[model samples]
Target: MASSQPNMERFLREWRQDALNKAQYESAIFIGDKLLAMTNDDNDAFFLAQVHFAAGNYTRAQALLAKQDLLTSNPSCRYLAAHCLIKQNNFVEALAILGEHTPTHLFATNAKRKTTRGVRAATARANSKTSSRHHDQGDDIPEEDILNRRYEASMCYLRGLCYAKQNAFDRAKEAYKDALRIDVQCFEAFSQLVKNSLMSPDEEDEFMQSLAFNSIRAPGDDPDMEDEPADYVQMLYQTQLSKYHNPQAFNTAIESLSTHYGLENNADILLAKADLLYTQCRFKDALAITESILMDDKYNFAVYPIHLACLYELRKTNVLFLIAHELADTHPDEPCTWLAVGVYYFTTGKIADARRYFSKASMMDANFGPAWIGFAHTFAAEGEHDQAVTAYSTAARLFTGTHLPQVFLGMQNHAMNNMTAAEEFLKTAYSLCKTDPLLLNEMGIVLYHQDRLKEAVKMFASALKIAAETDSDPHAWLGARTNLGHALRRLRKYDEALEEFDQVLRDGGKDAQIFCAKGLIYLDKERPEEAVQVLHEALAIHPQDPIATELLNKALEESAEAGDIGLLGTADAAFGGETSEEGGMSGDLASFEQRLGEKKFAARMKLARGRRTAAEMPGQSGGVKDKGKGVARSGRRGAVGGTRLFRGDQEGVDSMELSD
Candidate 1:
C-alpha cells in the first residue's frame, strides 16, 4: 500500500493541476485535501495548505496542520501557519511559532527576531549575575563568556533582521557584519551579509556558497529555546503600536527602542523615525535616512523603491537620476527603476528624453499609467496634439478615476485654438471636480473670448467666489479679476471696468492686459493724452505691443486737431479788433473788398483751404468786412473762393441767397 502511494499522489497532482488550469479552485482544493488525508506527507500537506490558503479557507488549513502535528516536521508548514495567523492578527501566537520554528527565515524570522533577542538577552544576563562569583574561575569563565558572546552575536543578528524588514538595508548589513565579527559561524548573520552584499555588486557565486554553508547545520547542534526575554514582549508591543498614526505612540516606540537596544543598532527604530518625519512633511530628513541606506553596499533591492520615493518626495531630482542610473546599470531587467528615471525627466522639462525613458518603461510594463502619461505630456510639448490626445485618452481609459488626463486634453485643445472644443472638455472636467479653480478660470476665459459677456461674467464671478471661499489660490483670483475687467470693458461699463483693473493691480497683478484695460477706459473718456501715456508705459514693459501702438496713434491725431482749432480762434480775435476801428459801413465794405480779393485769387488757384479761410476771405466786393460780428453776420451773403460760408439760417434773412 505504501509503494502505491507515490502513484496515487502523482495521479492526484495531475488532477489538481487540471482543476486549477480550468479555473476550478473548489475542485482543486477537494483533490488536494484527499491527497493530504491519504499520504500525511510534508510535501502533500504543504500543497494542501496552499490550495486552502489560495481558496480563502485559511481556517481549514490551520485545522489540517494542527491535526497532523506537521508544524515541527515541516518548517514550511510552520511558516504557512504563521502567515495565516498573521492574516488573522493572531500576532502573539504567530510570533511564537515563527521565532521557534523558522529562526533564520527572512520574512517570519525578521518579523519576530527583535522580540526574541530581547527575551534571550534578559535570560542570559540573569544567568550571568547568578554565576557572577564564578566569573574568574578558569573553565567556567571561558564557557560562560562564550555563551554570553554568542547571545550578544545572536542579538546583533536579530537587530539586522529587524532592519532588513523595515527597508533599512544599510543598517541591517552593518548589524549582520557586527554579528559575524563576534561569531563567524553564525549562519543567519552570514546569510544576510551575503544577501545584502550581492544587492550592489554582482557576487552571485559567493552569495550561493554562503547560502549553501549556512543551511548545512543540524537542529540538535543549535537547539531551539523557548524562554523568551521580557524585552521581546515590549518590542513586539511597540512594533504593533507603530502602525497607528498617533505621534505620541511613534515617539514612545522610538524612545523605548533606542533606550533598550541603542539607536545605531536599531534599524527598525530608524525606519519608524523616518516615517514619522515623512508624515510631518520633513522630506529632507526622510531623504537623509533613505540616502544612508543606499550608500551601503549591502542594501537590498526591496529598499531601493523606498529610497527612490524618499528622494522623489524631497525633489532631489539629480540624486534620483544617479540612483536610477546605477539601478538601471545593475538591474536592467527591473522596469520600476527605469520608470522612475522617466518620471524625473518628464518633470524637469526634458520631454524627448522623458519619452525615451517612458518607452523603455512601457516595454517592461505596458499598463503603467505614469509612463503613458509621461509619454503623452512629451508629445504635447512637441506640438503633436493628436498623438498627445490619443496617449492621454489611453491612460485615462486604463485608470478611469484620474483627472490628469482630462486636464491635459483640455489644455491641448485650448492651445490649438479650438476654443469651443476646449470649453466642452473643460466643462466635463468641472463637472467631475467643481472645486478646481483652474478649470473654472479656463472655462471663463473661453466664454469671454466667445463674446458671451454675461456668461463670462458669471463664470469669472463663480471662480472668484470659490477661490475666496476655499482660499483656493491667489493667482486664480487675479486671473478672474482680469477677465472680469475685460468683459465689463466690452460692455462699455468703463467705471466698473476701471475698478476691476485697479483691484487686480492692487493684488500684485502687473500683467499687460490689466494695463491695457485701464488705457481703454481713458480712451473712452476722451482723455486720449492720458491713454497714450499709460499705453506707452505698458509698451515699455512689453515692447512692440500691438494694442498700445494702435491707441498711441489715435491720441496723436486728436491732439493735432485740437491744436489747429486753438490757432484759428486766435486769428479771428486779431482780425475782429482791427476791423472794429472803422464805422460799421466802412469796416463792412473794407472787409467785403478784402474777402472778394482773396476769393478771386483762391478761385483762380482752385485752392483747398480751411473753413476759417472760407469765412474770413474777401468776397464779390473785394474788400475786408468788419460787420460787428466775428466773421460773417446777419442778413449778409458772402462766398469766398466759390465756397458759401453762410447758409440762410446763419444769414438771419428769411430767405437770403448767396451767389458765387
Candidate 2:
C-alpha cells in the first residue's frame, strides 16, 4: 500500500505556516480530511486536530483529541489537547490533561515503542514511522534523551502560559526559564518575557540579534526537515517590541524578514507595518495600507479602529461614517466599535449622538478608558465643566498607564480660565510623559499669562524642538512655531520673533494670527508703515478682528504724528470726573475688581442706612415727646383703647414729631 505519509508531512508543513491565505488553508483542510478517512490512525487524528486548532476551531479539535486512549496514544496528542483546552479558556481541564502526561523515561519510551521480551530488543523496528521530524542529530545524544527533552520543554511552556493567564507573573517567569533551560530556542517563552516587561531593552535587542547568528529550531521538530523557517508572528512581535526603543533596529529587522518571507502577502504583517506608520504620524500612508487590508477582510476588527482614525485625520467624513456604520454592524457588542463611531460623531459636532454612543460603549465595557473620555468630551461641549472633570478623572484613574486623560484635563481647565490649576495639571502630565509637545505648548501659554516671559520662551523652544521632530504632523509644527513667535515678541527679541512669524507665513501664508503677531512687533519697534501693511493683510484674512483693528489704529496714529504731528495747544474737551473702564491685559483684572467693589458698596449702604419717620398726631391725647439734648422725660402710662400705651394719659398731652 502506498502510505499517505509524505502528503501528510506536507500538509503539516503548510498548515503550520498559518499565513491566513484562503486558498492554501482550504486545500490543507481538504487534504487532512481525506488522510483521516484513508488511514483512521492515531497520527492522522492528531494531524486533523492540529489543523482544526490552527484554524481557531478549538471545540472541534478538543472533542477529537479527547477520544484518544490515554494509555496507548502518543503523549504529544495529549499535550496538544491541553493547548486547545487553554485556548477555549477551560484552564482547569487543560491543567488536568497536562497532569496525565509526565515527561518521564518510562512514560516516553514505554507507552508507544514496541517492546520484545523487554530486554532482548537490541534492534529497533527497521523503519519505524513517527509523528514528525527532528533536525538535531549527534552521535553523543541518545534518541530517548531527545524525546524527553522536547517533552519537558513543551510541558513547562504550557504551564507558564497558564500562570500568565492567571496573572501569576513571577511563577510564569520561572516556568518560562525552565522551558528555556530544556530548549534554548523556545521563541514563545522569550516573546512572553518581552511582553511582560521582564526583559530590558538591551536584553531584548541582544536576544533578537542572537537569533540571526544561532541555529535555533522552533519548539516542534520535523524529522524530515533539513531547515526550519522563522515563525511569522514571532518575527512580527519582536519587531513591534523593538520599534519604540530602537526604531533603526526595528526597520532593519523588518527589512530582513521581508526579504525572506515577503511580508506583503500576509495581512498580519501588513497591519503591524501600518500600526508603526500611524505611530510615526504618517497617517496618509497608514490609511492606504489599512484600506488595502480591509479589501481582503472587511470584518477584521483589529484594523477597523485604526482605519477610522486615519479617515478622521484625513477629513474624509463621509467615508469615515460609512466605515464606522459597517464596523458597528459587524461587531455590535464590541466596545471599540462603538468608541470609533462615537469619536467620529464627536469630531463632526454631533455631540448628543456622540454622547449616546459613548454611553453605550461605557455600558458595554465599564473599564474602557476611551469611552469614558468620550463621555467627558460631550459634557465639556455642553458647558458642564464639573461633570466633564469628573468623567476625565475616572478615565485617568482607570488608565493610569497613559497620559491622555491628564492632558485633556489640563486643556479643559485652561479653557475655563483656571490658569493656575491648568498649569499644575500640565506639570503633572509632563512629568508622566515628558516628550508630549502639546503639554509643553499649554504650559508655555500658562507661563506667558503669568508674565514669566523667559521661562515661557524656554517652554516654547522645547515644544518646537519636539514638534519639529514629527515632520509628518504639520499642525503640531505650525502651532509650536506660532507660540514661539508670540513668546519671543514678548521678550523684545524683535528680529528672532519676526523670523518665526515669517517662517509660518512662508509655510502656509494664510494664518491671520501669525500676521497679527508680526504687526504687533512692528508697532512696538515704531515701524508704523510696515505694521499698517501687515495689519491690513491680517484684516483681509480675518475681517475686523478686534486685536488687529486696535493695533492698526495705533500704527496709523503713530504715522500721522511723525509726519504732521502737532501737540494739542488746547484741550478740545475737558475730562469728565468719570474714568473709562480699564481695558486690555494690563488693567482688565484691576477694573473687574473695582467694579465688584462698587457693587458691594452700594449693597452695604442700602442695608445699613435705612430711613425712618415719626409722625405728630394732634387728635391723640398723649404721645412720647422727642428729647433733643440726650435727655429723656418719662410720661405717665395709660390705656387708650384695650391696649397699653407707652406714654399716654387722659389729662396730660404730649406732641409727636418726625426727626432726621
Candidate 3:
C-alpha cells in the first residue's frame, strides 16, 4: 500500500485537476461526488467540498461533509465546512464549527479566526451596537473559580478579534493587552495588538516594539507564519503614513520585510507596497515595482492588474497598448482586464477601439455596467444622441445608484433640444446625489436655458455653496461662477454679474464662454465699443465659437453705423488687419443701414430694456406698469406687421435669426 501510495496520489491529483476544469456546475458536482465516494481521506473530502463550493453547490457540499462527520473529526474538513457556511452567511453555524477547532491546525485556525470575527461583526450590526461600547468589555469571568486562567486569556484574545473586526481599535488594543499580560507568547494576541496599534498613531511605537521583540524571539520560525503578521502590521503603518502624505514609510516597511524575510516569502508585501504607491497617485513607482515583479516571474498574472492600473493612471498611452496586447494574449477569458483596456481607449479618444473592447468585455460579462456605460459614451461622442440615450437608459436600468448614465442622458437630451427632459433628468440626479456639485451645476445650466433665470441663479448659488463647503476643484468652482454670472446678467444685475466674470478671468479661466458672456452683458448695456473689444478678445480665443462670432459681428456693425471708425479699425486689426475697405463692412454701410432701420431699432431697444428691468424687479408694480405700456406699443407694432420686436419668444430670437 505504501509503494502504491505515490501512484494513488498522482491519480487523485489528476482527478482533482480534471474535476476543477469542468465547465458546468452540475457536471463539476457530479465529478466531486464520484471523487468523494472513491476516497476516504479527509484531504480528499475537503477538496471535493471545495469543488462543490466553487460550483455554487453549497447545499450538496454541506450534506456530504455532514455525512462524513468530518466537520468534527478532521480540522481541515471543519475549516472547509466553516468557509462554505461563511459563503452562505450562516455566521452562527460557521462560528460554532470554528470554536471547536484548535489554532495549532494552521488552515483551520485562520478560517476559524475569520469566521469568528465575521460572526461577531454580524451580531454587532444586527443589534445596532456601537463599536466603542461593545469592544471595551473584558472577558466574562465565570462564577466558578476552578476555571483555568489560560482559558480566560484565550477568551480575551477571541474577544479582541471580535473588537478588531468591528473596527473598535482602542478596545481591541486593550483586549489584546490583557491577553498578552496573561500569556506573553500568544501569537494571535500579539498579531491583533500590532494591528490595533497601527490603526491608532499614538500606539504605533508600542506596536513596533512588540513586533520587533516577537520577531527576534521566534527561532527557526516558519517564515509563512511571520509573513502574514508582518505584512499586516506594514499595511497599517502604510495606511497611517498615507494620511500624512508620506510615501517613504511604505517603502521602508517593504525594505524591512525584505531584510527579515526572503523576497519570495514577501511577494504579497511587495504587491501591497506597490498598491499603496498607486493609491498615492505615484503611478511611476507602482509601475516600476510591477515591472520588477514581472521580470522576476513572467507568469505572475497578479501583477498584470496593478500594471494596467498604473499605466492607465500615468496616461502612458504606448505602455497601455502594450499591456493590453499582452493581457489579451495571456488573459483572453478575463472580462475585467478587457474592460480596463476598453476604458483606456475610451478615455484617450479612440472611440472605435473602445467600442470593440467594450463589446468584448460585454460578451465576457453580460451584466458589466461599466462596459455598457462605455458603449453609450462612445455613441454619445459620435453625436448619435438617440442611440446614446437608448444605450445610456439600458445601462441605467441595469445598474442602480449610478449617476453616470443619468448625467449622460441629461447631456443627450440637452443636445437634442429637449430642455424639459434634460431638466427632469438633471433634477432627478440632483435629488439622488445632492452633494454632487457637477449635477447641481448641470441643473442650473438647464434652468438657465429654460428662461428660469431666478431658479437658475438659485441652483448655481447652491452649487457654489456646496463646492465651497466640500473644497471642490478650482475648475468646478470657476465654472459655477461663470454660469452664475450669465444668470445674474440675464436678471439685469449687471454690476454683480460683471464682478463674477472678472473673478473668473482673474482665476485664469479664459474660456470663450466667459468672454462671450461678458461681451453679451456689455452689448445689453448698449456699450457697443466695449462689446466689440470683449467679443474680439473672445474670438481670438475661439474664433469658431458661434456665440462669440455672432456677437462680434453685431458689435462691429453697430460700431460702424455709429461712425466709430476707431472701433472698426480695432476690430479689423484684431482680425489680422483686414480693413473694411478691402471688401469689408466699411465700404458697405448700406447693408448695415438697411438692417438697422434706426426708428424701429431704437423703439425695440427701449421696449427690450423696459421688459428686462421689469423682469428683474418682479414686485415693482410701478416699473411693471411702465413696461406694460411699452409692451402695448410693441404689440401695436406687431398688429401693424412692422417687425414685432420684444416678442414673448425673445429667448428663441437668436435661434430664429441664425436659422434665417
Candidate 4:
C-alpha cells in the first residue's frame, strides 16, 4: 500500500494540474474526490478543496477544508475557507471568518519569493500564539503568497468589499485605505480608492505619499533602489492614478510598462491610455483607441461607454444612431447599449424618448453612472433645473468617486442663478479634479458672474491653455476662449479681449456669440462704427439675439452721435451693396436683409442713423432663445452685457454654456 501511494499521489497531482488548466473542473473534482476517498490524507483533501474552489463549488470547498485538521492548524486553510464564503456572496459569513482586525504591522508583501527560514520560524511562533487565543488573522489568501504574508491586506480588502456591498461607503473607503497601508503594492485597494473617487485630489496625493513602498522590497529590487533616486514601483503606481501636468512622466511610465513588461497591447494598459486621452479632451483620438481595442475583443464592455461618449461629443448623429441600433439588436442586455440609445434620442431632439431610455439604462445597472448623469442631463436640457439638480445630487451621493456629477450640479445651480450653491459644488469638484478644461471653464464662468474679473480671467486662460496643449479640437475649447474674451473685456483690456474674440472666430470660423463679443469689445473701445458692423453680422446670424440687437442699437447711437457714417454709408444705398469692412461671418447685409425680413432690416438700418434706435429693438429679454449658449440663460437672469433686458430684450448669454 505504501509503495502504491507515491505513484498514485504523483499521478493524481499531475492529472489535477492538467484538468484544472483545461477548466475540466467536473472531471478533476471527480477524480480528486476518488483519491481523497481512498486515502483520506490531509494533503489529498487540501488538493481536492482547491479544485472545488476553482470550480466555484464554494460550499463543498469550505466543507472539505473544514473536515481536515488543516483548517485549525494551518493559516492557508483558514484563508481558503474564508474565501469560499466570500465567493458564495455570504459577505457577513465571510467577514465573520475573516475577523475584524489586522495586526499593527504590515505583512506578506512581495510574495513572489521563497521565504527565509527565519521568516518561517517567526510566522510559526505567531501562528502558535494566534491558535492559543482562538484568533485567526489570516483570511481569503491568494495562492501566490507562498507563506501567506499578505493575509493582513487581504483581510482588510475583503472587509471593504463587504462594507461596499452593504452601502457603507464611508467604512469601505477606510477599509480600502487600510489595505493599501498594509501593502503598498495592494493594487486592489488602490484601484478601489481611485475608481470610486473615495479620496479628494489632495487626499489621494497624501495617501500615495503615505504608502509604505520602501518598507518591504524583493531582493531583485534592491540594486534598482540603490541606483535610482525614485522608486520605480511607486512611479508605476502613480501612473495608475489621475493624469495631470507632467506629460513627460506619464509618457515614460507607459513606455516602461510597454517595454519592460511587454504589456503594450494589454487591455488594461490600452484602456488606461484611452482614458488619459479622453481626460485630455481628445475624444476623437480616444475613440480611435477604443475602436481598436473593441475590434480585437468585441465584448470588451469597458471601452464601449467611452466610445459612445466620443460619438456624442462629436455629434456623430448618424454613426451614433446606427451603433445604437446595432447594440440594441446585438447587445441588448448591456446597460451601455441603452445609454447609447438614450444618447441617440437626445441628439435627435426626442427629449421624452431620451429620458425614458436613460431611465431604462440606469435601471438596468444602478451602478452605471453615465446613465444617471444622462437622465439628469435630460432634465437640464429642458430647463427643469430643480429636477436636474435633484437627480444630479443623487448621482453625486451614489458615485462619490466621479467629479462629473458635481460638475453638472454646479452648472445647474449656476444656470438657476444660485451662485453660492454653484460655487460650493464647483469648488468641491475642483478639489477632486484640477485639470479638466471643462470644469475650469465652469469655475471661470461662476467667477465671472460673481464680478471677480481678475480671477475669472485667470481661470479662463488656464482652461484655454490646458485645452490647447492637450487637444486641437477648436470647437470643444472655443467656449474657454470666448469666456476669456468676456473677462478681458470686463477688465478693460480691449485689444487683448478683441484678439481673443478674433481667435475664436478664426478657429471656430463663425459663432454669433463670438461676433457679439467682438461687438462688445468694439463698444468698450468706443469704436461704435466697428461695433455696429460686427453687431450687424451677429444680428444677421441670430436676427433676434437680444445682446446682438441691443448692442447694435447702442453701437448705432454712438456711431450717429460721433457721426461715423462709414458703416451707415448713404441711407439710400445703405445695406444695398455688399457690406465692405462692415459685416463679418454673418455674411453681407443682403443675406441679413433676406433673413431678418426687409421691414425689421430697414428699421435697424434707419436706426443706425440714431432715429428711434430703441423703438425698433429686435427682440425682448423674455424672447431670448437658449441656443445652449449664454451666461444668464436662466429665465430673466439678465443677458450677457447687462441688466437692461435687451429690448428688443438684450440677449442674455450665460457664460457658463459648457458643451460637455
Candidate 5:
C-alpha cells in the first residue's frame, strides 16, 4: 500500500503541473488537494496553495502556505504567502511576511517548528557552499540556496509592485533594482523599472552592465540545457531591457535571437523587431511586419496599438477610419479599439470627440500610453498649453520607458516660451534616448531659440541624418532641413544655409515658412534679387501668406533701392495683389508695404510667436496634417485642432472595411 502511495503522489504531482501549465486551475486545485491529502507533507500543502494562488483564491492560498514552520524553512513559501497577501491588497501583511531586514524567510510564530522532510539536508548543503560566479558573489551558495535567492528576489519584486501601486516610485525603483540584481530572470520587476522610466539612462545602463548575468545560472540553465547557448537567457533578458537606446546593440541581439536560438519565426521576436522599427521611426516598415503578423493571427492585441500609430503617422485616414469602425464593432472592449476611434477623430479635426474617445481608451486600460498622448494632443491642438502640459506630465510619469512624452512636453514648453524648462525636459529625454528624429529636431529648435546656434545646427544635422536613413519619402523630413537652414542662417553661414534650403525645395518643399527662411538667408547675404525671387514664389504658392508677403515687400524695397525699375506690375501680378486698371501696384512701395504690414500684423504676431489661429488649429490636419502644401504642420505630438483634412472633400473617409 505504501509503494502504491508513492506512485499515486508522483502521478498527482505530474497531473498538478500539467494542469498549471494549461491554466486548468480547477484541475490543479483538485490534484493539489489529493496530493496534500495523500501525504500530509508540507511540500504537498505548498503545492496546494500554489494551485489556489493560480486560481486567485488568495485567502486560501495564504492560510495554507503561511504556516510558521513552512515559511521559516522555505523562501518560496514565504514569497508565495506574501504574494497572496499582496493580491488581497494587504500590503502591510505582505511586507511583514517579506520581513523588514531582507530576511529570506519569516516566522509568524515561534512555536515548536517541525522541519519538512529533506529540508534539513537542503538547508545544510546550502550553508556549506562557497558561491562562485562570473563576478564577486561575496559568498558561495549551494543548489538549495540558489533557489531560495530566486524566491527572495520575487519577494523584492512584489514589494516593488506594492510600492509602485502606492506611488512611492523612489522606493519602488530600489526594490526593483534589488529584484533584478538578485535574479536577472525577474523580468517583470526589470520591466516595471524600465517601462516606468524609473531610472535615468545612465543609471539604467550602469546597473544593466553591472549585473552578473554571465555568472548567474538558473536551475533550468544548467549544463543540461543543451538546446540553448549557456548565456542565451541572459542575452535575451538584455534584449528585453534598454529598448529605447542603442540601436546597433539591439540589432545584434535580435540577430542572435534569430540565428543562435533559431527563433527567426517566433511571434514574440517578430513583435520586438517591429517595435524596434517603430522606435527608429520606420513606421511604414514596422506596419508591414505588424500587418503580416495580424494576417496570420488576427487577435494579436499587442500589435494593434502600434499598427494604429503607424497608420496615423502615415496619414492613412480612410484606412484608419475603416479599421476604427471594424475594431469598435468587433473588439469593442479592447483599448486599441477605442484608440483607433480616437485616432480617427483626431485625424479628422474633431478634437473634443478625439479626446473623449482617448479618455475612453484610457478608462479601458489606464496604462494605454497612446491614448493619453492622443488626449494631450486634443488639448494642444486647441492651443490649451496648461492642460496639455498636465496631460503630457501624466504620460511622462506613466510611460517613462518611451521618450515621446518628454519630447512633447519640451515642445509644448517651447511653444509657451519657457525655454529653460524646455531645454531641461528635452535634455532629460535626450539622456534617455538620443536618437529619435523628431526629438532631435525639436531640441534643435529650442536651442535655436536659446541662441545656441552651433548646438542647434548639430542637433538639426543629427536629426536630418537619422530621419534620412529611415524615411522612405524624400519629403518626410523637410522640416529638419528647414530648421538646419534657419540655424545656419542665424550663424551667418549663408551659403550652407542656402544649400539646405535648396535641398528642401528640391524635395518639393511647399511650406511658406521654408520659403520665407530661404528668402531671409538671401537677404542676409545682401542678395535682394534672389530674396525677391524666392519670396515671390512663396506668395505665388500661398497667395495670402503674410510672412511671404512681408519678406517679399522688404526684398522689393531693397531691389528698388538697388536702382531696379518696372518691377511693380510683375511683382503684383505674381503675388496676386490688388492692381489698378493700368495693372500697376497701388501707392508707393513704402506706403503699400506699410499698409499691408499693418493689415497682417495680428497674423504675423501669431506666426512669430508660433501660435496657431483657430482656423489653423492642429487637429485640422488635411490628410492627418500634411501641412496643406503651404502650411507648416504643428510640431506638437499629434495634430492639434487641425479641423480640415489636407485633401479636399473628395477624399472623404468611407466605412468600407480593409481588404484582407
Candidate 6:
C-alpha cells in the first residue's frame, strides 16, 4: 500500500485536475463519489472534499473537513475551508480560522531559510560540473517542505484578501508580502500587491524585473534567451500594475507573456490583457482578443460579458445584439450575465431597459453591488433625487471600499443645490479613494460655491498635483487645470491665473470657457480692446453664451466712452439705473437743477448722492419699489456665467443650452 501511494496520488492528481474543469463538473463529481465509496484509505475524505469544493458545494466541503482533525490532518483541508468562508464573505470567521491555524513568525523564518537553501543548492549544483543528478536534486524541495510552503502561502494570501476587503490596505500589503516570501510563485499575492498603491514605482519596477527574468530558470543558459514556461500569471500581474500608468510597458509585458506561453494555452492571461485593453478604451483590440477566445470556447461566460462590453463601447450594434442573445441563451441563470447586460444598457443611456435588467440581477443575487449601482444610476438619470439617494446609500453600504457610489452621490447632491450634503459625500469618497483627481475637482467646486475661496484653491491645486503625478488621465489633468485657473481668478491672483490659462491653451485646451475666463480678466482690468478681441474668440466658439455676450457689451460701451464727460450717468446705468415708474430719479434731477453754478457738476453729484441715500432707506416706498423691479427682472437670465453644474464623464447631463 505504501509503494502504491505514489501511483494512487498521481492518478488522483490527474483525475482531480479533470474534475475541477468547469465543463466536466457533473461527470467528475459522479466519478469522484464512486471512487470515494470504493476507497477505505485515510485520504478518501480529502479527495471527496476537493471534489465537492470544486463542484461549488462549499458547505459539503466544510462538513467533510469538520470530521477530521484539520490541524493534524493535511493542511489543505484548513486552507480549503477558509476559502469557502471567504467566498461567502464570512471574512471575520475566515480570519479567525487563519490566526488559529497559521504561525506568522515561524512561517517568516521558514521562508528566509527556504530562500537560503535555494541559493546554496544552486551554488552547489553549479560547482558539481560532473553530475547531472546534483542539478536535479538541487532544484527539488522535500515533500514536507513543499506542503508547508504551500499551506503558509495559501493562508497568507487569504489573510491579505480579507484585509483588502475591509480596506485595511497596510495590513493587506504586509500579508501579500508574507505570501510572496513564503511561495515565490504565488501569483495571486503578486497581483494583489500591484493592485494596491502601497508599492512605489521604483520598488514595483525592481520587483517586476526580478519576477519577469526569473520566471523560468534553466540549467545552464543566459537568463534572457529562452527559459522554460514558468507560470505566465505573474506577467499578467505586471501588466495589470502598469496597464494605465505605463501602457507601453504593459504592452511589452503582455507580448512577452504571450510569446512565452502561447495565446492558445493561457486563456486567463489573454482575458486579463483583453480587459486591460478594454479599460484603456482600446475597444477594437479587446474585441479581437475576445472574439478569438469565443471561437475556441463559446460557453466561456467570463469572456462573453467582456465581448459584449467591447461591442457596446465600439458601437458595434449588429454584433452586440448577436452576442447579447447568445450570452443570455447560454447563461440565463447567471446573475453576472444579467448585471453585464444592465451595465451595457446603463452605458448606452437606455435607463428603462437598464433598470429592468438591473432589478432582475438584484433579485437573483441581492448582494450584487454592480446591479444595485445600476439601479441607482437609473433613478439618478430620471431626477428622482430621493430614490436615487436611497439606492446609492444601499450600494455604498454593500460595496464599502469602492468609490463609485459615494462619488455619484456627491455629484447628485451637488446637482440638486445641496452643497453641505455634497461636500460630506465627496469627503467620504476622497477618504475611500484618495488618488482620484475627479473627486478632488468636485470637492473644489463645492468649496468654490460655498464662498471658501482659499479652501477651493487648495483643493484644485491638490487635484492638479495628483493629476501630474499620475500622468495617465489627461481629462482629469486638463479639467483640474481649468478649475485651478478659475479659483485663482476668484482670489484676485491675476498673474498666476493667466499662467494657468496659458498652460491649458498650450496643452490643447482651446475651450470656449477658458477664453471666456481670460476675457473676463481683461474686462476687470479695464483693457476693453483686449477684452473685445478675447470675447470675439469665445463667441466664435459659443455664440449663445450669455455671460460672454454681456461682457462684450460692457467692453464695447467702455471703448465708445473712452473720454466721456457723462461718467456719472454711465456708472448709474451700469449699476442698476433708476426705474421710470419710481419718483427717486425725479427727486435727484430736481436737486441737480437747484445746484446750477460754475461748479454745478460737482455740487449736483453730491446732491444726487443724498437723494439716492434717502431712496435706499429701510422700509421706504422707493426701496420697496426698487426691490420689486429688481426681483421681477432677475428671472431665468440672471445667472450670468454662474457656477457650472458638475457633470461627470457621463453623457446627457450637458443637454441644457447655454443661454440667457
- Candidate 6 lDDT tens digits, 391-435: 878756544444546766886776667889988998887765565
Report the lDDT tens digits of candidate 5 across residue range 1-660. Answer: 886988888888999999899999999998788788778898888888888887889998888775536888888998898888888888888878787564423111112112211011211323433433232352256777777778878888898877776767678888887887777667788766654556554565667665545444434635433223324654465444444445555566677667756778776577666665555456678678878888888877656666666676677889888888999889998977887788787767777888899899878866555677777777777778799889888877765545666766776776677889988988887876676666676677777667687897898898778755643344656666776776676566778878988897888876666677777656545567888988888888898877677778888776775555543335433243454422123434435445554655544355646744323332222111222111100000111000000111101110000000
Prediction 6 global C-alpha lDDT: 0.55
The superposed Cα distance between candidate 3 and the true structure at residue 1, in angstroms, equals: 16
Considering lDDT, which of the candidate structures 2 and 5 is the better prediction for this target?
5
Each model's lDDT: 0.49, 0.54, 0.51, 0.62, 0.62, 0.55
> Against the hidden true structure, what lDDT does model 2 obtain?
0.54
Error of 4 at 209 (Å): 3.5
Off by over 4 Å in 4: 39-43, 69-75, 107-146, 212-236, 259-261, 325-333, 356-366, 469-474, 543-547, 564-660
lDDT over C-alpha atoms for residue 580 of model 2: 28
Off by over 4 Å in 2: 1-235, 242-246, 362-376, 383-401, 416-434, 446-451, 565-660
Clashing pairs in 2: 133-222, 133-223, 134-222, 134-223
Error of 6 at 423 (Å): 4.5
TM-score of 6: 0.60
Reference-based TM-score of each model: 0.40, 0.58, 0.47, 0.75, 0.76, 0.60
Candidate 3 structure quality by residue, lDDT tens digits, 31-86: 55665565676666777777788878787788778877887665456656766766
lDDT of 2 by residue, 1-660 (tens): 367777866665466445335535556666777766766777767777777887888887888877755313555776688888898888777777666233333211112212111111102212433434332332236656666566566767787777666756567766765565455456677545543333333444544443321123334555432222323433454554422234454555466566655765477566656655544446688789979998998777556545655565566778868867877887888976886788677657677897898799778955444466567767665555678778767755543333445655765675466878878877776755565455566677667666677887798788667555643354425655666676677566879989988986776746666676777666555566798999999899999676577667876876676456442121121111322222122232224334544654565346324421111111110111211100000000000000000010000111111000
Query: Residues 223-299, candidate 4, lDDT per residue (tens digit)?
Result: 43331222456556655555543454556667766765576887757766765665555667867887889889877
Name the lDDT of candidate 4.
0.62
Error of 6 at 389 (Å): 4.5
* Ranking of models by TM-score: 5, 4, 6, 2, 3, 1
